[model samples]
Target chain A: MLNLIANENMKIYRRMRTWILVILIVAIVLLTGILMKTHEAPPSSNWRTALQAQTTQLQQELTQVQGKHVFMPARATAGMEIQIKKNQYEISHNIAPAQYTAWSFTSTIEQRAIGVLLTVFVAIVAGDIVAGEFSSGTIKLLLTRPQTRARILLSKYVATLIFAVFMMAVTIVASLVIGGVLYGFANASQTYVYMDASGHVQQMGMIPYIFTNYAFNSVSMLMTVTIAFMISTIFRSSAIAIAISILSLFIGNTLVAVLSSYSWDKYILFANTDLSQYVFNGPLISGMTMTFSIIVLVVYFIVMNGLSWFLFKKRDVALT
Target chain B: MADQIAVQIRNLTKRVGNKTIVDGLSFDIPKGEVFGFLGPNGAGKTTTIRMMVGLISISEGQVLVQGIDVEKNFSQAMQHVGCIVENPELYKFLSGYQNLKHMARMSPGTMDARIDEVVKLVGLQNRIHDKVKTYSLGMRQRLGLAQALLHQPSVLILDEPTNGLDPAGIRELRDNLRRLAREEGMAVIVSSHLLSEMELMCDRIAVIAQGKLVSVQTLSDLMSGGERHVITSFEVGDKALALSILNRLFKDHVVDDDNHPHLISLKIDKERIPDAIQALVEGGVRVYGVSAVTKTLEETFLEMTGDGIIA
Candidate 1:
């Protein structure tokens, strides 16, 4: 099993494109850091003052939310209150706000936006891993080996996931290191302040929150990779697999938001992709909890991969 | 499952949709011999090879590689076999060495030294480190042969292995295959539409047409063994006089073919050659030259297939 996966890894890394993608990722992160530094926001001489200002801002937003009563005002009201209380707690504890710190680079909602870009990179690898072989006519060489189809495909799957995990880690670590170099490293050891799903303020050490936030964001990334890989195996066309994966990534959230009025929206595969939404932004619909989303994601994950494996093993590899 | 047999096909069949592409073909390839699948275009040679390697699903029957049924346990059966179906499909982005290394890793317990040895055996050591895309067609075919030999399989199956090779490359591949059969005791099955190449490369040939096996026999048997008194045509001066003298002496064996009256032809054995020539000369028909029309395998193949559309 190890040899199988190692063989795949060798094939993957030997491509110049994989390294180009990696380098592009690090370059993007560094460019973002440099731009943020050059156009530096107002320096927070004292985090206490920043926290007080943020708390006041959330209060005003909460009043406006109540006045308008639009766009799920209840959830919006709960979300504003949670953010305000968390800001107040940070202000009381004397933990200064620093968005550019290594920990904050991972934990901050704005910084977590980079995860989508990382998802595209990982999905590209997943999309190409299987379909690229077919396109290059190497699938004949691959399948005729001594291993069974199941073992061969399983190894490809494991290798793709490892690549996904590796890319995700690169995103996190690169951002963290860039953020630390541009800002300061001391904030990495600070406390992690956040709002839980129940509109309550919570606090944890920065290290734990840093890991959890990255891990939490990866649920959606893995979902996209699984879909991309499934398409790769079935269609044997890298272009179709990569295009559909990227299209779904950007359009999926909007479609869910547009179709939120429907009762069946909760069951849609895209609706359950962002598990972090349950804890970070609250559920898209009432009564949908993290555990419910977890169960849904697991089913879709298993079913998609089940179809991939079944088709990969049984389908005839014609002389394409 | 005989110890000497490396591969066995029993009633193997394939059907795509409503068309039966290959129907109930069976053959055995012995160890230490090069077996040839001789057929015309679209004769199902590739389809049968695909079924042996489990690339295409078999519609009926089975292929046994080293006594293991391919359909029942594909990996175990494939463990004893290595094959190249159609063109040698390789990862163009990878170096030739990396490609062979990848193939070597697929089979468990493959020695590291095996890759080096095969590289040398295929005469690819000089260019093995270059990317496959940079290599010429002949080099790629050599690399393909190298990878197929990496695991030291009991059976090697190559479909049209000489497709893109030059004359010299074809000769080199023929020499290597013969060496593999003789030195390593490996069973080899090579399919080709080139009858001359088959005659030079294979010890036995299986002729097929329209998805059905026509005949499978030793090369010599199929070529010249079964028939006695081969038709030998003589181009001589005054073929009419030569024909009369030879006809009177050997009767029925000698005749002046109406197609070319200047030449006399006869169906005579090796012992009767001197008598036929002496009769022609003593009759004042000066025999300028004596030659036998050695019927080529191409003629036999065309006769068996009933068509000349061989690829």
Candidate 2:
């Protein structure tokens, strides 16, 4: 199994596609730095002044909307209040939101759409994990080796998951380093502050919060990649796997939104994908809990993997 | 009860949908020799090979590679065998050396020395570091052979090994297979429509037509019909007189050549071409050409299969 996984890793690393993905991610990180730098107008060294200005602007906007009926949710008002309080506390303690802080970096990952980039790149590998062999006709050579079908398929799945973990690590490390280099590393040790759904301010260790962000974001990633892998083993064409996997990634979010109005939406794969909902986003469905979603996800993972292995093992790889 | 057989395919069969691709075929290949599978297009040669290599599932029966049942214990059976089905499929994105290295990882005991040996054997020394996408078809075929030989498998299976090879490449491969069989004593099974190449490469040949085994025999028996003679056809007028004269002269060797119904052809000694013409001429049959026919493996294959190469 280790040998097979090693072979798979070599195959993936030697391909231009993998390099392209790595380079693309690095380029995105660099581009984010440039855009952030150029977009920050009248750059201020003192974050206190910046925070005071932001608080005044938000408060002004809030007061103007008070006399007029607005469509904004009550949570938005609560979130704004928490943001103002957090900024005031930072200012009082002479704490500045350094341009390159790890907390800011986490926000960059979410705000600058790095998750989408990471997902697309990792999805490509997951989608191609099995089906690409058939499309390229190389599976014949692979299967002819002294390895069982289940072992080979397991190796591919492991390799893909390994790649996913590597990509996630790269994302966090790259963002923090690049954001630090471009702005200031002073905020690296600052705790991450955020507003939970209940309008409460939550604080956590910087490194732990970044890791938490990674873990939470990866819940959807893990599910999508598993789905992609399942599709890959079932279909011999890599194109179909890639197309459907990517399509479902975007479509899944919309589906969850459309279906969340229903009570049974909790049973859906997408509804369970955002595991961060337990601590961060809050559950989409009323009765859904972190453990409940975890169960749904585990069941899907097992069933999909079981299906892939069974089909791959029993398959008659006739021509392609 | 085991013999010195490298591969034993017992009552093998493959069926897809309503059609039986390979039907109840059985054959054994002895060690230290090259075995050939001769069939036209759509013949079950590739299907059988796929089954043997465990690329495709065996529909019925079993293939034993070095006495290990292929279906029941596939990894063990495959450990003794190395194969390439249809065209040599490889990771074109990787360099030849990397490709070989990757394959070596899968097959245990394929050390650097063994890789170098196979590389030299296939004559791919210089371009081994280049990506496979840059290789010509013949180069890829050689690389494929190098990969198969890396593990020192007891049996090597190739499907249409010389499909896109140049004349020199084909000759080079023939020499390599012969040397491997002689030096390493590995059993080689190759399937091809290239009858002449197969004849030059294999000691024994199995003919398959429409998924059924047609005949299996040594090269000499297949070509010369168990006699040390060449089959020759003489185009002549007075077909009845020529056929009768040839029948009487050559005895059991004389048969109506299905290839040319208008002329009578017979298996005769090459040196006796003049005697045949003289007999035909004296028998009042006008001989147009008294040429000694090339008793090519082509003739034997067509006769055995009873069908043309549709694909």
The number of the candidate with the highest DockQ is 2
Candidate 1: pairs in clash = none
lDDT for each candidate structure: 0.83, 0.82
Scored against the true structure, residue B310 in model 2 reaches a CA lDDT of 46
Q: What stretches of model 2 exceed 4 Å from their correct place?
A: A43-77, A95-102, A197-199, B226-296, B308-311
For model 2, residues A213-234, the per-residue Cα lDDT tens digits are 6777787787778888888888
If you assessed candidate 1 against the hidden native complex, which CAPRI class would it receive? medium
lDDT of 1 by residue, A140-256 (tens): 887898778788888888898888788877777787788788776764556655566676556677778767766766788788888998999888999999989989999998998
Candidate 2 lDDT by residue in tens digits, B1-311: 36688899899999888789899999999898899998988888888998998878888899998889988888888888888787878888899998998899988777888888889888899999999999999899999888887888999999888887889988988998898889989999999977888878999999999899999999888877655577677788778778889888888988686677467777777788788889988999998875566667786778888767542
RMSD of each: 4.0, 4.7
Instruction: Give stretches of model 1 more than 4 Å off.
Output: A41-99, A106-113, A189-195, A200-207, B225-287, B308-311
Tell me what TM-score chain A of model 2 achieves: 0.87
* Model 1 residue A266 distance off true place after TM-score fit, in angstroms: 1.4
Highest lDDT scorer: 1
Give the range of the ten consecutive residues with the poorest summed lDDT in model 1 chain A. Answer: A104-113
